[model samples]
Target chain A: MKKYKGYLIDLDGTMYKGTEKIEAASDFVKALAEKQIPYLFVTNNSSRTPEQVAEKLTEFDIPTTKDHIFTTSQATANFISGKKSNASVYVIGEEGIRDSIVEKGLQINDMNPEFVVIGIDREITYEKLSIACLAVRQGATFISTNGDIAIPTERGLLPGNGALTSVITVSTGVQPIFIGKPESIIMEQALKVVGTSLEDTLMVGDNYDTDIMAGMNTGLDTLLVHTGVTTVEMLQSIERKPTYTVGSLEEWIEKM
Target chain B: MKKYKGYLIDLDGTMYKGTEKIEAASDFVKALAEKQIPYLFVTNNSSRTPEQVAEKLTEFDIPTTKDHIFTTSQATANFISGKKSNASVYVIGEEGIRDSIVEKGLQINDMNPEFVVIGIDREITYEKLSIACLAVRQGATFISTNGDIAIPTERGLLPGNGALTSVITVSTGVQPIFIGKPESIIMEQALKVVGTSLEDTLMVGDNYDTDIMAGMNTGLDTLLVHTGVTTVEMLQSIERKPTYTVGSLEEWIEKM
Candidate 1:
């Protein structure tokens, strides 16, 4: 196996399966830490701040700090900043996205914004949607953190940011620029954050659709683990297979 | 001109535009009243009760009663009642839909309902959407009052029932049975309510997409009036034309 200089890894399914730690995943990260391999956890979850995600990883015995996380929220903020620094944004999201946008020195304006950014917001309301629709109709650049239609929960799949974003999209007849995995924008942002050249970096995740596709979309080699989401049967149906497939993260630890 | 035994007319664009009453529309309805031509106002608005709509029409001097109005909420209730009497439903809408369901003896149940119905709600919340998505994922038959993506308001075109419905539809990957204009289900229910045969009834409206398409879908002759949404240029683009076209209701009043 060719050794990559840096790694961009997915959280949730790849690292752990929703609060339950994957022991092999912990060992894999520990091995990377031991080998001094630079790695960053890239996630589509825009509701959680880097500290919260790092804390979660720490609980799972995976060595991680706030700087080791690249959230979609951060990517989204950086994306807007790149386009136009100090851009006025009307944001619909939880603390993560809000914090990211604020930290980036962007103006938060509801009346007339330069951009309308949507992330997963549990406290989503019709009024917020109305404001977003109005802003979009007024020619604001629409952007969504991710296009995850459903979020997996204990009860069942709940409505995700993509579904919520549809209200503004369907109403205003405006399509949002989605920045999460599977879309090349987030991958490019993650690559820049990790300071890795595309050819020398490996994108690792358990999901074929998001993680693996993100890697492929950004022209990076991908390693798909079977710890979560995509099963071997599900993977077989896909036309373009991941560069590497492993039964567990333990199998990929040797390469690090 | 071929005289029709009954008329299924649209509100908003046809009778009035927002709060402004169409002067010629009042005369047309008066002519229908004088001729004793049975007419029912079929509306896609599931937020207003039949009584409320009738009251509005009365204010405009467009001879109407509670019995002469058939809202999508009532149509939705009738549609559900036809399938299973007193069926439990998880509703995500306003008082109009709520009242219609209860009045029809149907139960409003949030947990494990037989059906999930969506209508326009200005006070839409994430919790309501979550419940609807959960219900739909649990195998509930999903239904939307209408598929009108944008609702015309003084501010501008706001998110409509169809746009709100996309949350559950996109999240659950379930396409709802839309029970409004352009759907034969609502038209069939309206036909039964007005006691009119499809061949003998004439549908009149200003919007070609909803009213004209509804009539066309139900095999009813449609009269397109150029007072509201669908303009002459828009009508020319459509492959299937309305049976009759007029500049105003005053032109149709002569035929009556």
Candidate 2:
């Protein structure tokens, strides 16, 4: 087995499932830490900040800090800042995305903006959607944190950011630049943050479509763990397989 | 021009534009009343009740009664009633759609509904959308009032019913049955209300896309009036033209 210098991990499914902690997750991180391998929790969750995510991971006995978290919100803000510093933006999201944009010194403007950014907003309203549509029609560059169609909860699968984003896309006839998983944008940003060469870094997650595809799209080797969404039976139908597949993160600890 | 036995007229673009009334609309409807011709106002607005719409038309000096108004809300309710009498429905709209559903003796159920219907809702919330999405995913038949992408307002073109509907459609990967203009559903309902045979009825309106296309789709002769949305220059680009083209409703008043 090839030794990886750094790791890009996925949350929700990989690190934990909803509010429940994955049994093998803590030990796997400990193994990586003992070897002094740097790893970042690359997540598509744009609702909560890194501090919040780190706190949750800490409760699960997983060694984590705010610096170890790299959410899609941060990637979206970074992408915008790379294009133009201090650009005016119309945002439709919660605290995480808003804070990230503000952290980058981007101006939040409702009337007229250079860009329109949308993230998962559980408090979403028709007025917010109307403002987004009007701005997009006025030639604002549209951007979404992620393209997650449905979010799993105790209640069942609910409409995700992708579903909400479709309102503006369908209305204004404008396609938004998605900055999260399965796209190279967030992966590239994560790679830069993790501070490792693509060849020496491994993308580890349980989702084939988002995490694995994101790694493949970014020219990084991927390890698919079966502890979450994608199962062994489900992966058999896929043509291109992940570089490594394991029943749990515990199985990969020996190799690491 | 061929004489028509009945007339199906559009409301917003044909009769009035926002708070302003069209100059030729009153004289045209008055001519229909004078000739004792049966004319029904067909509107895609699922927000306002037929009585409210009729009151507005009467205020504009157009001879209108609640009986002469046929809105998409009524059409949608009629459609649902035709499928299953007293069927439970999950509706996301204003008073118009809700009133029409109750008038049809249909039960409104948020949990485990037989049908999930969506109309234009200015007071739309994420919770309402989440309920609709959950219902649709749980095998409820999905229906939308209209597929008009944007609504013209004092502010600008705002997100329409179609845009709001996309959230569920995109999330659930299920296409909804649209019940408004450009679809034969609303036109068929309007024909029954107006007591008009498809061959002898004339569909009249200012918007070529909705009114004329609805007529064409329903096999009715269409008269496109250049008072609102569709202009003379715009009509030149369309390959399939309306049966009759007039500069204003006044031009057709003499023919009626």
Candidate 3:
């Protein structure tokens, strides 16, 4: 078996499931730390800051710092910064996206902005959507953190950012550039932050559509764990299989 | 030219355009009244009640009463009442839709509603959308008043009911039954209200997509005026043209 020099990990299903911690997650991180191998928790969650995500991981006994977390919000900020420095933006999201934009020195402007960014906004209002539609119609570049259609919760599957973004797209006839999982943009950014070559890095997750697809799009090997969304039976139905499949992280500890 | 027994007239582009009355519109309606020709103002606006719309028409010196106005709200109510008399519904809209549902003896219920109806609501909230999504996912029949993507105002085009409806559709992956112009449902109901036969009734409007398409779908003759959305150049591009294209309603008054 080939050994990877670095790893890109998923959060919700791979590291933990909601508030519950995965028993083998801490041990997997400890294995990487002992070998001095680089790894970053790549997440599509643009709602919380890296510090918040790191704190949650610490509670789960996972050895991760703020530097080990790379959220879609930071990727979006970096994506925009690469295009143009100090660009004006009209944002419809929570603290994490706002912090990332501010941290990258992007100006948050509602009227006549160069870009219109949408993330997960639980407090979304018609007025906010109206402004976004108007801005996009006025030729602002539309961008969304992720294209997640529905979010799972105790209540059930609620509307996600992609569903909310459809209002503007359907109204103004403009599709947004999604910057999160399954898209090569987020995976490429994660690779740069992890400081690893694509050939020597492995993208690991329990999901097939987002995580494995992200790895495939970024020219990296992918390891699909069965501890989360995609089961072995489900993977068999898919035409393109991931590079590796395992029941849990414990099965891959020997290779690490 | 064939003389029509009744007319289904569009409001925004035909009778008036955003608070300003067309010069030929009042004269055309007066000609209809003098000849005792039956005509109903057919509008896709689900936000305003018939009484309110009638009042506005009266202000513009157009001969109209609440009985002469046929809005999409009333058509939706009629459609639901025909399906199941006094059926329970979960609605998202202003007073217009609520009043119509109640007038038709339909019950307004959020918990386990038989139908999930969407109309234009300026006070739309995430909670309201969440409930609608949940109800739709729970096997409730979803319905939308119109599929008009944008509403033209003095401030420019704003997000319409169709845009707001996309949120629930995208989240739940359920296509809603649209009951407005271009859908034929409202046109069928308007024919009943106008007491006109399909062969004798003429659908008149300025928009080619909505008014003309509705007429074509319902197997009625259509008259396209040049005062609103469709232009002579635009009409030339369409493969299926209106039965009669005129520069103004005054040209059609002689035939009436």
Using Cα atoms with residue i matched to residue i, what is each candidate's TM-score against the true structure?
0.99, 0.98, 0.98
Candidate 3 clashing pairs, residues 3+ apart or interchain: none
- Against the unseen true structure, what C-alpha lDDT does each candidate score? 0.92, 0.94, 0.94
Q: What is the lDDT of candidate 2?
A: 0.94
Q: Listing candidates in order, what is each one's chain A TM-score?
A: 0.98, 0.99, 0.99
Q: What docking tier does model 2 reach?
A: high
Docking class of 1: high
Model 3 TM: 0.98
Calculate DockQ per candidate and list them: 0.84, 0.86, 0.79
Give the per-residue Cα lDDT of candidate 2 at A108.
97
lDDT of 3 by residue, B1-256 (tens): 7899999999998999999989999999999999999999999999999999999999999999999999999999999999999899999999899999999999999999999999999998888998999999999999999999999987678999999999999999999999999999999999999998999999999999999999999999999999999999998889998999999998988898
A1-256, model 2: which lDDT tens digit per residue? 8999999999888889998889999999988888999999999999999999999999999999999999999999999999999999999999999999999999999988999999999999899998899999999999999999999988888999999999999999999999999999999999999999999999999999999999999999999999889999999999999999999899899998
Superposed model 2: Cα runs more than 4 Å off: none
Docking class of 3: medium
